[model samples]
Target: MRLNRGLPAVASSLLLALPLALAGCTSFGEGSEEPAAASATPTEVEAAPIEWSDCDAQIQPLIEGQPGSERDLLFECGRTEVPISYDEPAGATLPLFLVRATPAGQTERIGSLVVNPGGPGGSGADAAIGLALTLPQDVLGRFDIVGFDPRGVGLSTPVDCIPAELKDRVIASEPRPTTAEQLDDVFALSREMADGCAEEYGDALGTFNTVDTARDMEQLRKSLGDEQLTYLGYSYGTTLGSTYAELFPDRVRAMVLDAAVDPDTDVVADAEASAAGFEAGFDAFAENCKGLIAGCPLGDDPRRFLEELLAQAGGAPVPSSEEGETRQATPGVVLTAVQAALYDTASWPQLAQGLRAARDGDAKALFSLADELTGRLEDNSYSNLLDANLAVNCADTDEVVEETEVRRLVAEWSQAYPLFGAGSAAGLFTCSVWDAERTPVPERDAAGSAPILVVGNQGDPVTPLPGAVDMAEDLESGVLLTWQGQGHTAYPKTDCITAAVNAYLIDLVAPQDGLTCPA
Candidate 1:
């Protein structure tokens, strides 16, 4: 799945609305029993404990300075080394970066509660700061929030494939190639990206698979002195969490997986589902914006209007201006802007404004949204998000359809889902030529594990609700919690959902199966 740049509004709002609550008397019982040893040999010599230090210089100052964001100042940063290949514990190792925030005041701490904010590429250390600030006080008091950048992400041993200049060109390339020349260019760029990674990292690229990361998580658990894993994972993070549960079923105390990625979904099915999801989200946005806004940009038929707009951009790229830097908006940029907005309905108003501006021949708003989605900063420097996302995803799955099949799917899906199908299909070639040994997504039954909570949003565009449903059913003890709402994940969307998750994580009382909260 592509990265969803939008943060859950409920989380941000909660952080702004409430001051950090000091810890109080809250006793979490002893941790769960340890599971059977993993298949990989345990290190003969235990790894050194993490050396904690103030992270003021490392954390982003803007987030630290935000109101009610003291946790950023309180966070401690550190690094730990683990074997890049778990099968060879004495072989090459990679350093994993971590950020941890403890409770404000003394309380009976449960243990370190690990978190990953989706991405397979997102900086979990960065996410920990946000999670520390936004999570409810009661929940905050009971657990030490720890976020780690996985083996090939963020501050960890990063996978730098494409250079910034080349990446900019790639992201701005034409999304839906209609002609042979354009298609050739698309294929060339895809190979360029994959080959670049192979050249930079060599065989090490194959070690970034989720299964390896799952082993790294176990090492992290031991390093943190936690008896078992307690986790909160969203979107792609759910994949990591489920993989961990599958690999070490008895190692879990509690886990909350929101906006799940179905392990069973192949690349083609993933593209098709994502296309339908974005179309559904767009339809909902169009219906809600009809009478709510004056001169709705989409008019009566949003589907048709968007299709025409995409076609127009493809033929002659729309010009976009930001802070005097001018660039043309290609179909790729437009689609990225749309996908970013689909993550959270709170951005729907901005999406409307952007679409309206685009219709009026000004693509500034849309370009800004696209820049945000792709992590293009004000200084034009890009993060390694796109790089690591591709690396990890390519390493995880082996399903690769040929360009001809992808083109056929695009043509068929474009007719079925006019808003996003062709563009979604256009993205199918990203991992086609990746040079990593594939690790199939695990079954994630997690039999005999503690009750795991799976939260699903009804109208999630990226990881649709059905994936969550399938994920819940796949896990032996999985409890499904439904949030009848919009957006990518549900925990930070509603009080009802948040309360349910908080209860699960802090109290280990999973919400009833089939529980549904209204939008």
Candidate 2:
């Protein structure tokens, strides 16, 4: 949500199994050394054209048993090579995966409309395939909906650092470590995960930064035979879209950024803001929970109740068993469950149910919610979301806070934001000991880009509304479209927002700036 470097499980779980919120790739700062002339522009040499093929065998099952026309949708998959680092176009390359969906019955097409959901690690190719099944028919008829996995993400060659078992252990660890030894153990695990990535990836890890991914997007644009880019990005995807606008503003035809990440917030500030935001969201949920059902699970004071529960879990995790596997529901696990539910208001009821069950000494419901957030399947396999999230995030920044500073922040944040403060603070050290060199991209105004539509949700816990406000104002030609609603991004959630977005993408008609659509 905040696009912070640490807290992969919290961030990735925000849009679990939902490609609509996948993030795009982009650089956040300039390279340590001046870029070679070659890096300034892609090589003139033509990359091989994509050879699209029927992907029905692999993609169709994802939508199997679903109702309506989506069942018959067709998808084409392809891959293209881009230089791992733009500085040396003739050097080693990486494969970028693509999934394209063309209108089933339309002859005249408007152009390509690329979509990114937003995990600095989210799979764009997967998002594209999902979009093919659910996007409005008119939108489908006019433009080729494309989803691409940036380098070091799904479908593309991924950064597989920690093994499934190791990752499970890391995620299932306690969130609030009271003792110095507990804290030391947390930091040690972080170091091991980071070191494992470096060992597995080597120098290739350096190329996973957003800048390289932004350049790859440009390559994608060219390969699609599009003269101008028409793009839709959510969450961290906004980072990619904004970076592209900064680097090649003139090439953008139309772009929509929903649930934007503020370009200015540092790691510490981002975590603090995220903690505050989730606290706000939890409060909203608690308020709505009142009177909706008898004997509300969170009780009269949800905040206080949660604090007690977390404290209890911290000392001794509740025992939970699912499918013959037993695990203790630690504070981290409980926090993950709560965070995952906060993503969609519809899940609030489920959260209440889970919490009620946890209170009664049955931890299965909470464990399921935690598994959903962490991508831990029944068989104990993982989706690689957490691995890629850390790989890309750690590679993007070079800020490292000492353990003492982290502990201080945890104390500070706990005072300010009780619900998620300490838990959020615990994630501060994730990128501190990472092995990759940071290639930070400077935040830009994106001065020459065409009018870009920026959408923000009123109740998003991850990418807060203020970040969207900042992002819209920072882009030279950006316009804000506010949704007075609860949830992450606006489009496709409500008819009003969806219609406006469709109109904007199809006709290039910007919504009245600052237009507020009802939830």
Error of 2 at 314 (Å): 3.5
Residue range 406-494, candidate 2, lDDT tens digits: 88887777778776887678788888888776777657688888899999888888888888898888999989998888766777778
Best-performing candidate as measured by lDDT: 1
lDDT of each: 0.76, 0.74
Off by over 4 Å in 2: 1-45, 67-71, 293-295
TM-score of each: 0.89, 0.89
- What TM-score does structure 2 among the candidates reach? 0.89
Compose the digit string of candidate 1's lDDT tens values, residues 153-263.
766766677788877778778765656677678778888888888777666677677877888888889899999999999898999999889888888999999999876
Worst 10 residues of 1 by lDDT: 21-30
Runs in model 1 deviating more than 4 A are 4-45, 57-60, 64-67, 70-73, 293-297
